[model samples]
Target: MKALKPRRFGWWYVAEWRLRGMRSYRWTILLMTLGNPVLYLAAMGIGLGALVRVDVAGVSYLHFVAPALLVSTTVAEGFNEASWPVMSGFRWQKFYLGMSATPLAPVQLAMGESVAVSLRLWVQSFTFWLIGLAFGAFDGLVSILIVPIAVGAAMATHAVVMAYVATIDNDVVMTFMYRMIMMPMFLFAGTFYPLETMPVFLQWIGWISPMWHGSQLARVVAIGLPEPGWLIACHVGFLAVWTIGGLLWARRTFTKRVVV
Candidate 1:
């Protein structure tokens, strides 16, 4: 076989390494990917939905909340993927330092890690959509769009968290992030209720949250939620900006940290 050229396809090699490592915990990932949607949809869509007799956002409560749940779950998983894994590569396992010793550049490593996480997000989001279909939470075939919308939001979230994680040396910040940042976004970012229903001061959380943006787009496609064209454009633009900007930031940080 020809000598493998790391320089020409270093990112793919890095991604392959990370993906193979995931097999160690394949059973755990499989359980969560399949189990989470089933439990949440059952409890929220059927159990709690029974009491929510009135329409929310012009649809049954289950229909309105389903897309939000889908986006939120994927975003949460993205955060998990970006956080400890990046830390482990840098501090615990020191795999990033090892990769740096080879021909692989730090940017390549970042891109590879991101690609793997995005693939996981895609799988998780699609599974959630399928479960939602069985729950009768979707409006029609258009609801399938939620899968990609969820993946985009999750990737944007993953990039942002990864950029931050690349700079930290310890887990203190990660703990703070989970409790202070992620939890607040989960509750206030239009996951369970419309942002307008919240206190005006608190509604800003949804405005800046990727989950809310993704949820808005998911709702639009999943149940035909009424939204203006310009607002829809804003959602797409925000996620695109976050994903692009965060990736650039992560690449820069990864180089600074690992290439030293």
Candidate 2:
């Protein structure tokens, strides 16, 4: 008799399923990945940049804002990937539960979802970067390096949001996250100006915000913004911890929900 083949989990297959579902909305994705950067860069980076009438941090206003927008777009896209789709899987579609009936474990499903979304984010970030380059918002090839840094920060945010979505029973909390949490961070996280320029009390908001950390890193790479080496290390470390911790929590939560 032939030896029995070991049953293996096929998480990448799950990711492929998710990607196929996303194909139905390819136009929306295309518009967003291509249009958003251009619209924002032209509006804020150029239009608002015109009124400033003074350089920011020794570079054109467009340059200073471009990287920040890149970070913001990446984070926003990351959060979005983890939000409604997650809820649909658990609450509406029950696709995760169905997957659990197979050899696919909950942790595998969680990782598969995360990977699919990360791939989407990668494409979006690439589009955003190319638009920035075309507009001359970035200085040189060195600015290309900021692309991965921004994506890493976005993935950190994505992981945390996924963990949160795993525990939620309704979309209400997700709404609050977008309106209260995401919007505030987007507005106040040193995206438009240096944190020091903000009121001292409000500056702390940026200190803890992932968007701020990512933007700081992007600014460092894109424009050579002066930052202490230690501070840079802290930025990278903070993002890394959040990414790892959040994914672990998500995996555990997903296991509990599906395997129970």
Candidate 3:
């Protein structure tokens, strides 16, 4: 318990300012955040579903695609939070420097920022799920059980972030990060189509993408799909592995930069 509490505090410590603002703003973002999923439902699910004319995982294209959308958006949002926001805190904002002036270690700040960012991503998933509810797009209340799954997506994003920090020097790479990496993952991660239906060579990407794992789990939970117990375990296990592994790498990068 002693070890666990400080780790929890490390993440919480990163988001103190944002949390304070949220408490005061008490800002409800459910509607605003719903915009992307709604557009997704319209453009991809309904738009593309119109032409696909095939069932995936025994559900209509929209129903099958919706839950994955819930998880991917959360994963992407986590990467966004970890990247520019953390960079800004360190570079332009110098907020971490000020926090460093306090007793809060830089490592805690980094972890806290990741966790804070994860919280934002979690909200994105929750809002998307609520929207899924209104449209009758989800199959079961077990859908709510996927919050932790969405958090796993956040960890996956953070992994991308730790790997990203090693390469950063200019603003140009950010464009590459999104265009080359994030975009491809979005399209091919079995979000709109089943992994089995894709070309065999391309299927490898989905196998490695954290977004894909989280997305698949969300779909199973939300729709009450009759997946085998072990398959679900694989999805959840990959995400958990990424989350823990990413935190370790991120700690190393943060310590390397901030401590010495």
Candidate 4:
């Protein structure tokens, strides 16, 4: 085989390798991409949604919740992708060390992992959007924008988590994050209802959560949920900051952990 030069296109090479590794669990991915929407839409959109007759956020419960679900699901997947896989790269599998032996830079490794995670998030978000459409949970064609919105949210969340995970040496922090941070953000970040419904003190959770930012954006596009222009700009800016800042942080941590 010809010797390859990975310096210029190292991130793409790393992304390709990560994608090929995903084949090992392709069935799991397929099941999740398909089954989650069916079950959630059936339960929430049909089961509980029917029970609550009043509209939520100016639309039927199904339409209101569908976008939130899409964003939340992708965000959760972002955590999953960033957590164990990142840890495995450093600790379990030590793949980062192996890759570092080659010409690939540490930053390239981070970018590649991020690219792979983003691609998966896009597919999952798009799948959920299609299923939401079938269930009549969307307003119109413009709702397709929710797909990218969800992906952006997921990437922001994933990048931040990956940055943190790169620094940890064990799973204890991961467990703490899931129980104390992730679960709270999921339940309280305006996923199933409006943030204002909660007490004022608790609303801060949604304000800082990527899920909430993404959900709000998704709702606006998916069902025409009324939001002020300034708030929308804030959401976009917040997620952008998290995504870019997190990627930079991950690059630093990956270099520190893998180059030693």
TM-scores for all candidates: the values are: 0.97, 0.95, 0.86, 0.97
Worst 10 residues of 2 by lDDT: 1-10
Which digits, one per residue and each the tens of the lDDT, describe model 3 over residues 1-260? 45566555755765777556445434444444768778887787788888878887878888888888877777776776667666666666767667776556656866676656667667777778787777767767788866678778767777658545633656577777888778888889988788888999999888888888888788778766676899888887888788778777766776666666
List the lowest-lDDT window of 10 residues for candidate 1: 1-10
Write the residue-wise lDDT of candidate 4 on 1-260 in tens digits: 33356767899999999999999999999999999999999998889999989988778898888899999989999999999999999999998899999888999999999998889888998999898889888768899999999999999999999999999998998999999999999999999999999999999999999999999999888777789999999999999999999999999999999877
Best lDDT among the predictions, by candidate number: 4
lDDT of 1 by residue, 133-244 (tens): 9888876888899999999999999998999899998899999999998999999999988999999999999999999999999999987888999999999999999999
Question: How many backbone clashes can be found in candidate 1?
Answer: 0
Question: What overall lDDT, based on C-alpha atoms, would model 2 receive against the true structure?
Answer: 0.88
Clashes of each: 0, 0, 0, 0
Runs of candidate 4 exceeding 4 Å displacement: 1-5
Query: Considering only N, C-alpha and C atoms within 3 Å, which residue pairs clash in candidate 2?
Result: none
The list of candidate 1 runs beyond 4 A from truth reads: 1-4
